[model samples]
Target: MCASACYEIGCALGDAPTRGTLALMLAGLLWYVGFIVVASILVSFGAVDSTRRPGYRRRDGKQEGTLMWPSLVMTAVVAASFAASHYSLT
Candidate 1:
C-alpha cells in the first residue's frame, strides 16, 4: 500500500516527468488498487470472521516515546521511498 501510494504521488511530482513514467506509475497504482479491492471482495464473501484469540490487553502496553507498528511501517516505507527517489539522482 505504501509502495502504491508512493508511486502514485512520486510520479506525479517527479522532475522531468515523461509519458512512460506516468503510465508506469498509473499502472502500479491500478495494480495495487486492484489487489486491495479483490482482497476486500474475497474477505467479504468467502472469508470467515475467525478470531483466533482475543487481543491480550496488557498494562504498559504503550509507551509515550514509542511509535505504533502501523506508524513505524508507514514511516519506514516513506523514508525508504524518499531515500530511493532522492538518491537515484535520475
Candidate 2:
C-alpha cells in the first residue's frame, strides 16, 4: 500500500518513480510472505516457540492465517487506477 501510494504521489508531484521502485516493492512483499510462511512452519513443528502478545482481534472468533491475498489485490487495484489516471491526464 505504501509503495503504490508513494508512486502515485510522486506522479502527482511530476517526479514519477522509475520501474526500479516497482521492482523493489515486489521483492519486499515477496520476502515478507516467504518469511511468514517459514516462521509459521517452524512454530508448528515445535522448532520455534510462538507467542501472541495482546492485540486487537476481530469480533468474530475466526482466526485468519494470512492477509496476503487481499493486500496484493488492493495494491494491484491502486496501481491500475494510478496508471489509468496517469494516461488519461496526458
Candidate 3:
C-alpha cells in the first residue's frame, strides 16, 4: 500500500524520478521484507545469544541512509505535485 503511494506519486510527478530511484525503492522494500523474515527466524530460535548473533546494527546506518532519503524525496514529490496541480486549477 505504501509502495503504491510512492509509485502513484511518481506518476503524478510526471515520472520525474530516475529509473535508479525506482529500483532502489523496490530493492528497499524487498530488503525490508527480508529483514522481517530474519527477525522472525531469530525469535523462533531459542539457541541464539544476542551478543554472539549477527545483528542489524551493522547495517542500520546504511539501511537508514538508503531508506530515509528516498522516502523523504518521494513524499516531497507527491506534495509538490499536489501543490502544483492545485495552483494550476485556479
lDDT of 3: 0.45
**Candidate 1, residue 38: lDDT:** 55
Clashing pairs in 1: none
> Would you list the rank order by lDDT, best first?
1, 2, 3
Lowest summed lDDT across 10 adjacent residues in model 3 is found at 61-70
Clashes of each: 0, 0, 0
lDDT of each: 0.50, 0.47, 0.45
* Local lDDT at 42 for model 3: 48
Candidate 1, residues 2-70, lDDT tens digits: the string is 455556456564654687765665554565455556546545533232323234323555323222444
Best by lDDT, which number? 1
Q: What value does the lDDT take at residue 57 in candidate 3?
A: 40
Question: Roughly what TM-score does model 1 have, to 2 decimal places?
Answer: 0.39
Per-model C-alpha RMSD: 8.6, 11.2, 12.0
**Which of 1 and 3 is the better model by TM-score?**
1
Task: Compose the digit string of candidate 3's lDDT tens values, residues 14-90.
Answer: 44367765565455445435544554554454234333434534554332223445446645654564454334321
